[model samples]
Target: METKKNPNLEIGRNSSIYFAIGLNIMLFFTWRGLEYKSYEKDDFAMEILDIGEEIEEDIPITNLEAPPPPPPPPAAAAPDVITIVEDTEEIEETVIESSETDQDDEIADPIEVSDVAVEEVEEEVSVPFSVVENVPIFPGCKGKNNTELRNCFALKMNEHIKKHFKYPESALEMGVHGKVFVLFAVDANGNVSNIKTRGPDKKLEEEAYRIISLLPTMEPGKQRGRPVKVPYSIPIHFKIQN
Candidate 1:
């Protein structure tokens, strides 16, 4: 025997529609809960004024009169007479010379240069290597005249640079290479000083400085037969081979 349930009492006939409606309702409530705001209550008690109540005070009238200020003191009387006496001591007056002059004034005497004291000051002089009367002599350089001496000096300088030239190991590892321009001064005593080096890298500059500083003390360059300081410049190139 089969017993069939009534169509009106079927539980699962509209179950999907019910579940969708319920889910939508739950989502709406959840959104509202997330956005809910609350405020602290301000418990201010308000008082009502009763217009029918009568309030009165029995205050008495008080009369006050301020006293007047005191009078000022009288002024002292001044004497009308002034005395004069003859001053016996003579005061020397300074005479101020007038800067203005007229044609009547005589012209000053011509100054003789010999009468003026002249002081001679000795100052350090620096001359260029090319124009100097005497070129600084490097070690083992000898020549008969200034022209020969300049050539020998240049040759010796190249030889010295070649002898002392070195590559910095750090520079080699870093692949740093450049041409360094070096400017140095030979002092009046023929000592190397003021060595300045500029290059693409500091390593190259330091290497140039080291090589230039190793230069031996030379005979100071002369100008007009007086030994003087000299400035020289040269370029040193650094190249690395792979």
Candidate 2:
């Protein structure tokens, strides 16, 4: 016996069309269930309360009488006459004269004024190395012009540093190597006044200060043809060679 195949059993042939139709039908039913609904508004009536009018009453006034005035004062009596008698005895009075005329005639002694010598105050001003007209002359840097003198001054300073460069033995033993900044001022009198030093170690600072203090007295810098203080700063480096 031979059996015939059902058309619905052949799903592979029309499965896509059937699936699309079923999905569309489900979507339509879902949209209809979720439709928006609007409510109807109810009408309301407003009521107002009535207010009564205010009433006023009139007040009455009474008349009063005033009292009478007081009586006047009495008149004053007359004064009596007096008689005075003259004295016959003579009185001698001594008159005192003013001494202001004698004081005016007398002359005061002249005050002797002694001559006092006033000491002049010298103003000590600091001038920069670059802008100073007459820079502090380093030893052996004489006879050079202003610009040449400045350059020579710097060269001489560097040469002096190298000549006197000494590493502190304590600093070297401790493996301390750093730079020290030394500041010194050449005063108006060509003498080094203030010397300051800063370094990483006390030994290094002391070495720097000693080197600076050894600097010979230089020719004082001049500004406006007058001697002034010149401040100079130099950095010294200390390093240990391998």
lDDT of 1 at 226: 95
RMSD of 1: 11.6
Model number with the top lDDT: 1
Residue pairs with backbone atoms closer than 3 Å in model 1 (clashes): none
Q: Write the per-residue lDDT of candidate 2 for residues 106-205, one digit (tens) a residue.
A: 6777755555566898666889777888998988896548988888888988988888889988889889999999988889888877999998999999
Q: Against the true structure, candidate 1 has what lDDT?
A: 0.92
> Model 1, stretches more than 4 Å misplaced?
1-121
lDDT of each: 0.92, 0.85
List, residue by residue over 96-140, the lDDT tens digit for candidate 1. Answer: 999999999999999999999999987999999899999898878
- Looking at candidate 1, the ten consecutive residues that score lowest on lDDT are 38-47
